[model samples]
Target: MADTGIPHFCNDLGVTLIEVGSKEFMCIGAKPPFDHPHIFIDLGDDTEHVCPYCSTLYRYNPALAAGEAKPEECVWHDDPEARTAA
Candidate 1:
């Protein structure tokens, strides 16, 4: 499928593209196998999201950054709206 929008395999609810600051948004992935096989995605050791504009990697899963969900909060939430539009 073409990358016109979000992928179906991505459980919309699991992750949300929240705007942290300015034009920077976090691509939080949801559900298990957070590492989706279809796409070459990686959250990195700190599970930080790299900014496309400035390349600033901000950590997702606030808990992990604060010593919570150490395992990693790559789980993505399902977004029904996003799916319907797609």
Candidate 2:
């Protein structure tokens, strides 16, 4: 929402939801300009986890397949350097 030129996973209400394929993942909070330190999280026995930095909730979806999530599905963005330069 900070216009970091990144496609965020957050909805209109500003609540971010990430569907992950694995139990362990990292959360960067948001893109640059609104980014937080990357934090590694492990779902372990749980189905979901929340990032402490941005309070983004990450859920594990079996349908995603390991390492098969699409970029848009995960809210990925272009290069940060290019976005910042603009």
Candidate 3:
């Protein structure tokens, strides 16, 4: 599947909670190679969500910019063109 252009979040560091900017985005259990299936997560009107695969809790914050995460490192960047042809 192609990227949905939404922000991607992860919990590779095993953080208790990840604060995100967008209510709708992807929760890649971790970065690719060691990542689980990228799951689409939508907070809707709620303030928080959890990734079923990794059980990582995510909270939404209006103070953040789209694609931003509290820990910063939780932001997963999927650059298809950067991948080597393998």
Candidate 4:
């Protein structure tokens, strides 16, 4: 799959750092089972922010080329218990 320039929403990835053009961004915590209410975040002067829904951390990386965001994978963990056991 090609890079869509969108932040990865997979919880398995843990903390995800996404590069954005501005301090404001939106997070949906991925699709379907992992999906959460879409919310807008304002980092203001801060360079990093964490999503309140999934606790995914997003950071601003100026080194990233224009129209490029952090890479992400859409993977589903079928066993919810496995996560808790870890």
Candidate 5:
């Protein structure tokens, strides 16, 4: 996984709307081991987008950092070492 610098998010907390830092990001539905397809979501001109697999709604907040999320736990960090060990 070459880091494209795209932020990743998860809905494991089951929040209604996940406020994210960027309009363009990857939605993992939930955390790994129970996550759906990591779908690339580009809001484009819009401020919101819904994950097609898990129906998780993501809203953009300009005040957030690129990797930040409203609930904080929604921000996902992939573990490359875990993938290698598996």
Candidate 6:
């Protein structure tokens, strides 16, 4: 399910179940794996994951609304113009 296309997080707000190890959603395989404050279901495989802290799902992605440029393609760290020249 992680091979068909791009992975996305469930934008839905509410309490949801997640996998034990993978830390993803329990039922719908329609999202990515949880890595940040929000949990993510595989969306393609229906994996489940739960937060160890507040028992909330967690997920992290740096390319969701990144527009035409991806997080990996960002130049924040390399762009001297965006930084103070010391």
Better by TM-score, candidate 6 or 2: 2
Native-to-model Cα distance after best TM-score fit, residue 71 in candidate 1, in Å = 19
> Which ranking of candidates, highest TM-score first?
5, 3, 2, 4, 1, 6
lDDT of all predictions: 0.35, 0.61, 0.88, 0.57, 0.89, 0.32
Q: Write one digit per residue (lDDT tens) for candidate 1, span 17-73.
A: 322211222333333335233332344444445435323344445432222232233
For model 2 the TM-score comes to 0.62
Off by over 4 Å in 5: 82-86
Clashing pairs in 4: none
Give the number of the best model, judged by lDDT: 5
Per-residue lDDT, model 3, residue 15, is: 95
Off by over 4 Å in 6: 1-4, 18-47, 51-54, 57-86
Residue 79 alpha-carbon offset, candidate 3, angstroms: 3.1
Output the better candidate (4/6) by lDDT. 4
Q: Pick the candidate with the highest TM-score.
A: 5
Winner on lDDT between 1 and 4 is 4
Q: Tens-digit lDDT track for model 5 on 7-86?
A: 98999999889999898899988888899878999999999988889988899999998889999999888888987799
Comparing 3 and 5 on lDDT, the stronger one: 5
Expressed as tens digits, the lDDT of each residue in 16-57 for candidate 3 is 899999999999897778889888998999999888999999
Model 1: lDDT to the true structure: 0.35
Deviation in Å, model 6, residue 85 alpha carbon: 32
**Could you tell me the lDDT of residue 56 within candidate 4?**
80
41 Cα displacement, candidate 2 (Å)? 0.6
Stretch of 10 with least lDDT, candidate 5: 1-10
Ranking by lDDT: 5, 3, 2, 4, 1, 6
Off by over 4 Å in 2: 1-13, 67-73, 77-85
